[model samples]
Target: MSFLSFSPCCVKGGILPGVPRGDYDTSTLKKVGGYHVNSSDGMIGDGKVALVIFADIFGLQVPNCQILADGFSDELKCHVFVPDYIPNPPPNSAFTQVAKTFPEEYANRPWYISLIEWIKTIFKAWKWIPTFLFQGNQIRLAQAAVDNLITEGYTTIMSIGYCRGATILEYLLSSSSNVIQCAVLCHPEPKPRLYNHINRPTIWNIPDHDTFFKSNEVDILKRIMGKKVKDQGLEFECFVHKDTVHGFANRPTLDHEATKIAFEKVNNDAIEFFKRHLLQ
Candidate 1:
């Protein structure tokens, strides 16, 4: 079963407090070995470590995603690249307008129409058709970006994925010959099979109130991860943010103090995890 939650609330976009509300600075955007990268100079050491950010469905063009990418570069003092997996991503205005009306529009659909759509979905599923077939293309694009970074002399590569992007990262990690050294998954849509195959150190930032992973689901994942930790001595860390919801890390509900606290805490934890695994 797919772990992805196609909830309207999950897709509803908003900007977090303290984050800038526009595109990344022009100076930060440059070509690195034939790949566009948002780089941060003046790294503390001589290590050639870099972070690849696989953004959520909103894609790399979203201001919140860009802000988070820039924040990671600034915090880690390393080169960060947010590849344009969606070449012609929807603009912010369009996304925001849709997000605002999606719930009401969905509710207003005729019952027969909804039933027909459900039947079509079931038929597609029965035929083994992938719901997010476009993800295959995104994976290839992300791989190219990673390969480009390696060509530019990066020795170690760490990945940070949000939402749908997390599934892509998990696919890479589960592959038999991926070069990703470590990963940080924020509000991931982790498949059950991933727990058994992940070899590298991973930090999972799970929101306690996630619509996709309820308490029982989270317990099952914890048990699976716990077994892996015990049997393989893997460094699979899971941090469940109390009183938090999905998208809290990137687009936190700033009105809530707990969400704000969880956002900062998760960011700090991810930074520390990267330092321990990749920088040291």
Candidate 2:
């Protein structure tokens, strides 16, 4: 069972409000009705629409996701659920280290199995669990959350994710028939190898900072787009922020002047895209 069982009463009680405000390693993921699994809640208008903002590997500690959540809640007038899967005070170990620490015998274990083991070590050493195990589980939990929200009277559903979170959301979008009106990704991981399974009105933001956004990166995106990126099907916008790095826009620590300019333009575009695709 999910640690955070999607419950309408939880949303009504306003228990899940905005992302957790603390360091990931030191924070316990707030659970809606079970163990630790923190979440935030807000909406655009009067709570007619809903959005779920999933975060990258660093978990909700990335301030950009928080900024986006605030802006999205305002623009969409829908409750936003930003859940933290990474336990607090993240284990002092890096993902690569955690991945390597598995018993030599478990080296070939399934990715999910290895991830659970990692979470166990992390939770035992500290009060937190590594989000590595939540990789494939976030969307399923998110979908359940949406279903719960729908019972609370939300009609529209939208999802947005950055980096690895976006990659997972893509999988969720492709697999589920949930009423996800539209899905957007910013700096998401490209589909491994050639992905020929895209089927949604998607939009991507590519800034100049990410290494992959360089000339070669554009080629890769183009290759990925291969025929899927069209005016009507999917809109791929590469608005390079003259000079900026990854995690620029919503990341306060890295928010450069260029990031500000880029985000101003992209944020507006995102609102319009969601409005057109999700509400209209």
Best by lDDT: 1
lDDT string for model 2 (124-183, tens) is 554334354445566556555556657768787777776656666667666636566677
Model 1, residue 5: distance off in Å is 31
- The digit string of per-residue lDDT tens for model 1 on 33-103 reads 21123334567446487888887766755655566666677667776776666444434443332232111
Q: Residue 222's C-alpha lDDT in candidate 1?
A: 80
Worst 10 residues of 2 by lDDT: 30-39
Error of 1 at 159 (Å): 1.3
Clash number for candidate 1? 0
